[model samples]
Target chain A: MTATATNKQVILKDYVSGFPKESDFDFTTTTVELKVPEGSNSVLVKNLYLSCDPYMRTRMGKPKPSTALAQAYALGQPIYGYGVSRVIESGHPDYKKGDLLWGIVGWEEYSVITPTPDVHFKIQHTHVPLSYYTGLLGMPGMTAYAGFYEICSPKEGETVYVSAASGAVGQLVGQFAKMMGCYVVGSAGSKEKVDLLKTKFGFDDAFNYKEEPDLSAALKRCFPKGVDIYFENVGGKMLDAVLLNMNVHGRIAVCGMISQYNLENQEGVHNLSNIIYKRIRIQGFAVFDFYDKYSKFLEFVLPQIKEGKIKYVEDVADGLEKGPEALVGLFHGKNVGKQVVVIARE
Target chain B: MTATATNKQVILKDYVSGFPKESDFDFTTTTVELKVPEGSNSVLVKNLYLSCDPYMRTRMGKPKPSTALAQAYALGQPIYGYGVSRVIESGHPDYKKGDLLWGIVGWEEYSVITPTPDVHFKIQHTHVPLSYYTGLLGMPGMTAYAGFYEICSPKEGETVYVSAASGAVGQLVGQFAKMMGCYVVGSAGSKEKVDLLKTKFGFDDAFNYKEEPDLSAALKRCFPKGVDIYFENVGGKMLDAVLLNMNVHGRIAVCGMISQYNLENQEGVHNLSNIIYKRIRIQGFAVFDFYDKYSKFLEFVLPQIKEGKIKYVEDVADGLEKGPEALVGLFHGKNVGKQVVVIARE
Candidate 1:
């Protein structure tokens, strides 16, 4: 057996301008020793799955002080994101060889990581699908939990509206709202996603936003009373329309603005006066902020998953070469569900 | 005195579009009984000081289900707003002849009101100028109180920004933030108002927004560490700039959008994605929502006034004839401070 292996990586060509193209990412090959450095508390892992998220688009943009949560991806370097991996070697006290984990990892076959608590998690439940770590049981799960329950401050029998409904976070947010006994409605870009929301995810109502000329009228139709909680996944015109349709004292938990991420200049939201008129609360949040609540989230959602009370779907793209297209497809709403790029089966 | 007295009134000529003008208001005189009808459970009040507030502009717009916290002013009818008045006659158990109160009253010489608790506050501390009830002790006061302390959730040593800083609510917000030990910066339309913000309102820094070509650059210059709490009065471009300059987990208390109220199509606020990037919370609120906290607010600010620790400034427009210009001048940023139209001194 060789001590080193060839590692393939996806590297950003340059900082993106408008919408990112698949060609913006280039593949590179390098050889690396499959061992952690002596006396270093880092862990070496083999990448299994890489999660494609809307926030990734933000990271692709030109680096600025005001750029959201994640720092901009460096040119000619392998982009890192939430991924499932198996430890090849461990110098970290908490992890051991063959231990599965999920966290910010390079989009390469093998990479060394300084395992920080919360940022990286040693997967305990191998009972569930290990690839679920890239999505349902990982960052997106925590995001939906914190944003819907905490930020939204939801109540039973209230109405909820989720945009990007069939995506990793939105799908879970809809289910969580329903479990809380709230009437949940969702908007997705495709008819297939809309169907998934209504049929598979248990959303009370779902709409293909592309089919609706007037988003405000669509929201009014879906929520005859008014939207009490808006899980904002898409920004721009959708946000403007939602502002007009929101109920008095409505809460908008902004998890992501997928639509605005790719635009050079973000669309101007005009119905902001409705914010004051409705006494609405629009809160923007990141998953990193609520990492502490992860254990409690796992406790709540694990049972639901085991009992079939909860469901998760993923659009898996096989192999490292397909990573760029899988990610770039997210902005186009080409993925029907959670987009995950699989590098290895085991 | 005659049983019937001629009552002079400022009437809304029609529903206003674009910038409101003095011509939008028409004055008329009609006979009033000067006494409440027997068993009517109402009080007849002789108007003294009428408040000219920016939110009143929303009331003049064509009525819609989403017309903010106020109803539209009916054409050819007397407009109603916060005013201080002396009770000429009373059938309500809560009020008596010669009692002074402040509430929603007709913009007329004498008005009959069915006094509701909290909506109408009887003068308890008459030593302070009675006209103050139209501003410092009234609705705008409560607005500043609720928005800054409760919504902003300010911490000591936080950075606070106030827009339209020389106006009624903005002045109070700056002062309150200063009292909370926050570093306060404010933006006003003119040089004189900017000086008033720093000197009279005790704002740490002040800028004339009209002179600055780039609002965001001005904010960055003032808030080097970024704004922790923003008391949003003027919306549109100012709000967009504030969003860019907000610190992580910043709170924006949206009180009024005077800039957008007069426009046929409201300006689009493009920086909303910052809500998530910075984890910002933008809350829209009304004074009506916080009336329950009135006594608590009074207890907090009344002592400050009595000790001369707090100072209030008002640009007084004398006589009922000047009420039209006084109210309309608010949109033009012509009023130096809290704009008040005095109908009678006693």
Candidate 2:
């Protein structure tokens, strides 16, 4: 093994009780050997882009019951999420010192990962911004693809409504629905995000839910025909309102419930009775279930990104020291788009 | 036209707002000429057994936006529901005088009807009790079969949890799950209903939800392995607890939400976040959607009924005057089994 190098990490101070604060994570430093362990097929990686996702809020909570949604971030341990990393040393034949990959890695400057096919996908066609791997091409991309097509079972010309429209998964869902000849409407928290949804993401209509007193009335105004598919990102009140406006035989793809996460008490959904009256199908899914379709997702989305047919926006925070703020900002809806912490521009 | 007969009818007094009282309906007399009009395909029938169901509550409310669910029962009109009748006159070739049919009928002693294939099922196998058509071997039977097999997608040895497990659809769902070799557990309002779920319906275990202080704890005690499929009958808090107890990728077939139907304020479901974490699928379905499978269903269930593999109990009210009490009894859990109002025996 070569000489050890200094590694900086963002550590979870403890399990969060309510809305997460930046103080919940502390900056720390450790030393790591540059070389892969002897007789092990692990790859030593230098982290480039670390994703700050709404799902991480769930991990911040005390580990109560283990769920497929996410594993709890251990107290006093480095928080982990999807990231773009360059291999610095390789013990596996398929990976080398220069190969780029996107997968689960530590929220730190360096990580040694067991490069299993399931967790990691090789970064092919890196001509597009490498940071795209953190949002558009990584977990969020598969989430948008699988949640919309497989779970929602989208039909052409169907009306789609997306909540948290400016976030990582929501933006892509609107674009995909629009591309498939759907009339898409989206809801976000800010005027700027709402504008971006309509202009950049090409949503047929967009509204700032925070500005609207009655979400059901807002939905009624935007979608006179009623929502056929709802790509749910923020749950609670948004879900309840969407339920009231859903068409018969509607589909709701529960991708994330950002609004409910980190709350001591989750907002109760009242309009669930509408599900029976409308024959609605509300399905909850994880992108992990569709990782097997990553190649197919890449095949479809890469060209769209290259041709400027698909667009992605990011809110980038510099250095591991700013990681806490970037992750915490998600709860406050501070970030305009996909939030990422840049460890280094490898 | 033959001599007119005085028909006793149950008419909706007005659109119900909250919980329906017996006064929501009025007993009245209407004269009916028991003859098929010239060149009309409508059948004139003597209504026998009238089904008192939870879904009728939806119809009792004033019409809102149209849904594929039950149509609203108009004010001052005779309320209609599923019933068994003997055809007194028929203009359609498919039916003739003396033929027994079961389907949608007015809550009256006699009704003249246009009977389409979708609205009527001719009784082919009457070796069993004729009143079974008002409960099992009718809409509730098809509901249980389709909701369990098609929606829940049961596999042998899977843990099944059903609410309202001694009611019409719940009883059959538990029994069907048991027949499929599942570990079935059910919840009902009273000790009698709970006991019926275990000893009579063959559910592996049962609990009286009213007796349990904490339903989630009861479910945990009953299903330490967690629920694989939840047949949701009475929704609200029961659904909230079930969400917490659901296994990964569990399915919840939303059959009815009797608890929420009549309240001026519907109960908000709190634990829906578990859906995303568990990758659960909650689907609302109507028995009308699976009517085409009626033939196939009868073929599967008829032998079970004859050989006593399946058992159904009915709480029968003797007259049309008692229809309001029989139907209203469902909400208070007064009926031990399927509640039916017998307008006439033959």
Listed per candidate, the RMSD to the true structure in angstroms reads: 1.2, 1.4
State the C-alpha lDDT per candidate: 0.92, 0.91
TM-score of chain B of each: 0.98, 0.98
**How high is each candidate's TM-score?**
0.99, 0.98
- Tens digit of lDDT per residue, candidate 1, span B1-346? 5499999999999889999999999999999997777779999999999999998898898899865467898999999999999999999988889999999999999999999986898888888998888888999999999999889999999999999998889899999988889999999999999989888889999999999999999999999899999999999999999999999999999998989999999998888888988999999998888999998988998999999988799999999999999899999999999999999986
What tier of docking accuracy does candidate 2 attain? medium
- Predicted candidate 1 versus true structure: per-residue lDDT over A98-211, tens digit per residue: 999999999999989999988899899889998898888999999999999999999999999999999999999999999999999999988888889999999999999999
Best by TM-score: 1
Question: Candidate 2, which segments miss by more than 4 Å at Cα?
Answer: A66-68, B66-68
Ten-residue region with minimum lDDT total, candidate 1 chain A: A61-70
- Per-model chain A TM: 0.98, 0.98
- Top of the candidates by lDDT: 1
